[model samples]
Target: MRAVAVTAFGEEPQLMDVPQPEAGPGEVLVRMAVAGLNPVDWRIADGMLKDAGPQSFPMVLGTDGAGEVVAVGTGVRRFTVGDAVFGRFWRPAKGGGSYADLAVAGEKDVAQAPRSVTYATSAAVPTAGTSAYNLIEETRAGEGKRVLVVGATGGVGTFATQLAAGRGAEVLATARTTKADLMRNLGSAATVDHTAGPVAEQVLAAHPEGVDILIDLVSGPEEFGAMTRAVRDGGTAVSTTGAADADALTEQNLRGFNFHNRPSPQLLEILAGQLDAGRLTVLVGSEVALEEAPEALQLSRTGRARGKTVIAL
Candidate 1:
């Protein structure tokens, strides 16, 4: 199998022929058509998960993908040969991932692909889509609520903006002027120009009362704290980057927590439904071949990619 992988942590990724993986117990072997590139994919290659667990060499990059099930291991019953699916395929300890000709995913991590979207789009959904959906559900952004989605031009932010707006929330997204129209089309009620000045200042200047919910996707502790100033008393603030200070927020009469994505087959099904029904749009900003994964990782590192990047297998 041809895969893009790293021989060691912090090493550059390269395309090489590797041993084909098989479906073990509770797994499903997928002939991947496309793989989604997330920041974590490169982070893992850079040793982000080193403290979490053991890792294997030649670790293939990527977690999310869309493909057809070619075989199923024992105990897997929901899918069979020829069924199309999409979801997580990350297993670092085993040197397995989605950026390959064939990948093995836990049966519980995958679901049927959306019929209305292409394989590239479906490949882009598992990580970013699930994170966005979970964030909106946790914040309960809906009618009468004001939600602020920082880094709203990114993949997760794009979906979060739409999901919050679909529920009637007044969504305020932080984006550059060039992306204002795109943000608005994704259901943002207002677009804050982050490049103009401080994001919190601009937001507070517009909504003096402050927003009810805050979703910070691209801030560190310092900037995330500043953003929370735009959250009203008794409002909720969440960070996907582990930047939330729960104790400090509690003292200020605000709810705060760090959000880590927990995507399930069920959640994937729900997201697929949204896509199939045209309520959600998967933004595939760039597409690359499997061999170009190293360049894609470099692009992700520069933080220049606008939306999701999909790798065709």
Candidate 2:
């Protein structure tokens, strides 16, 4: 089987002929149709998470994927051969990932793919979908709440905007002018042109009382702190990039925390249900063949991505 992988951490990923992987106890082996590219995939390859856990060489570099199950291991009763599935497939310790023709994942991280969409779309949902759902739940975005989504055109941002709006929150999404219409179409009540000026200024100028919640997906610590001004006292601010100063925000009479997503099979199933009901959609900006993954990975580092990128296997 052919896969895109690095011989070692910090090495560039390349298309190589590697041995196929099989499911282990409590795992499932999937013949991948598509693999999703995420920012953390590149970061892991760069050794930023070297201390996170043990790893194996010739490590495959994809986190999410959609495909057909080819085999199941002992104790895996929920899935069978030929079942269509989508979810997390990154097992660095086993030198396995979704970039290959076949990948392995713990059963708990795999779930039935949304029947209403193609494999390409389902492949893009796991991480972004789960993150958005968990964020909305944590902040209780709903009727009467005003939620602002920073980086609202990116993968997780796109989902977050829709989910927040679907729950009846008035969504304020930050995007470039080019994506203003798209964001509104995705349910943003208003759009903030982040490129024009400070987003906090624009948001506050329109919503004087401030939003009930802030979901900061792209800012650094200083910028996140500065943006928290858009959240009213007693409101909440959540940062996905570890940019939140919890104590400092609390001192300002606002609730703040660095968000950590907890993805689960149950969440994936709910997202799939949303897709099936036509209440959710996946936005795939680019799709590359497995062989082109190397170049695609390089382009991801440019930080200009507006939507999800998928690798067709």
Candidate 3:
């Protein structure tokens, strides 16, 4: 099997021949049609999870993908050969991932891909969508709440903006001036030009009264703390990038936490249903073949990608 993997943590990923993975108990073997790229893909390849999770050399590096099930391990009854499925695929303990011709996933993180969605779209859903959903769930954002999404043009930010809007929150999204229309189309009530200066100042100017919830995606601890000032008294602030100052925010009587997403099949199904019902959209900015993924990943690391990038097999 052909896979893109790093020989060791912090090593460059290369196209190399590796042994194909097979289904184990409660797992399904998938013939990947497409793989989705996320920041974590490169982060893990660079050994971001060295202490937090298992690590292996020659480790494949994709976490989300869509494909056909070619075989199922014993006790797996929900899927069989030829079933179209998609979901999170990386398991550091296993060391294998979806950046290959074939991958394996446990039943808990796998779900049937609806026919209404393309393999490319399905491949893009798991990580960003689930993370967005989890963030919204934790905040309990909804009607009348004023919500702000920083870094609103990336994959997870795009989904978070839409989901926050769908939940009836008045959404303010941060993006470069060029993406103003895109943010508006995604249901943001207002768009802040993050590149101009401090986003908190821009947002504060618009909503004189602080927002009910703040979701910051691209800030460090200091910047995130400064941004939390825009959260109204008793409001909530969460950072998906592990930048929240929880103790300080708590002392100030505001809720704050760093978010970590836990993906599951049920969440994927709910997101897929929204896509099917025309309530959700997955914005894929580009598609490349497996051989071109390395370059695409490099380009994406610039942190300016406007939408999801999928690697078509």
All candidates: TM-score: 0.98, 0.98, 0.97
Candidate 2 lDDT tens digits, 179-282: 99999999999999999999998999998999999999999999999999999999999999999997999899998889999999999999999999998968
Candidate 3 wrongly placed segments (more than 4 Å): none
Q: For model 3, how does the per-residue alpha-carbon lDDT over 60-157 read when each residue is reduced to its tens digit?
A: 88989999999999999899899999998876666668989999999888898967979999999899999999999999978999998988899999
**Model 2 spans with C-alpha error above 4 angstroms:** none
Ranking by TM-score: 1, 2, 3
> Between candidates 2 and 3, which one is better according to TM-score?
2
Report the C-alpha lDDT of model 1 over 1-313, residue by residue, as the tens digit. 8999989888889999888888999999999999999999888889888887877888998999999999999999899999999999987777968999999999999999999899999999999999999999898989999999998999899999999999999999988999999999999999999889998889889889999999999999999998999999999999998999999999989999999888999999999999999999878999999989999989998876879999998
In model 2, the worst 10-residue window by lDDT is 297-306
lDDT of 1 at 25: 93
Weakest ten-residue segment in model 3 by summed lDDT: 88-97
Clashing pairs in 2: none
User: Which parts of model 1 are misplaced by more than 4 Å?
Assistant: none
Which residue pairs of candidate 3 clash? none
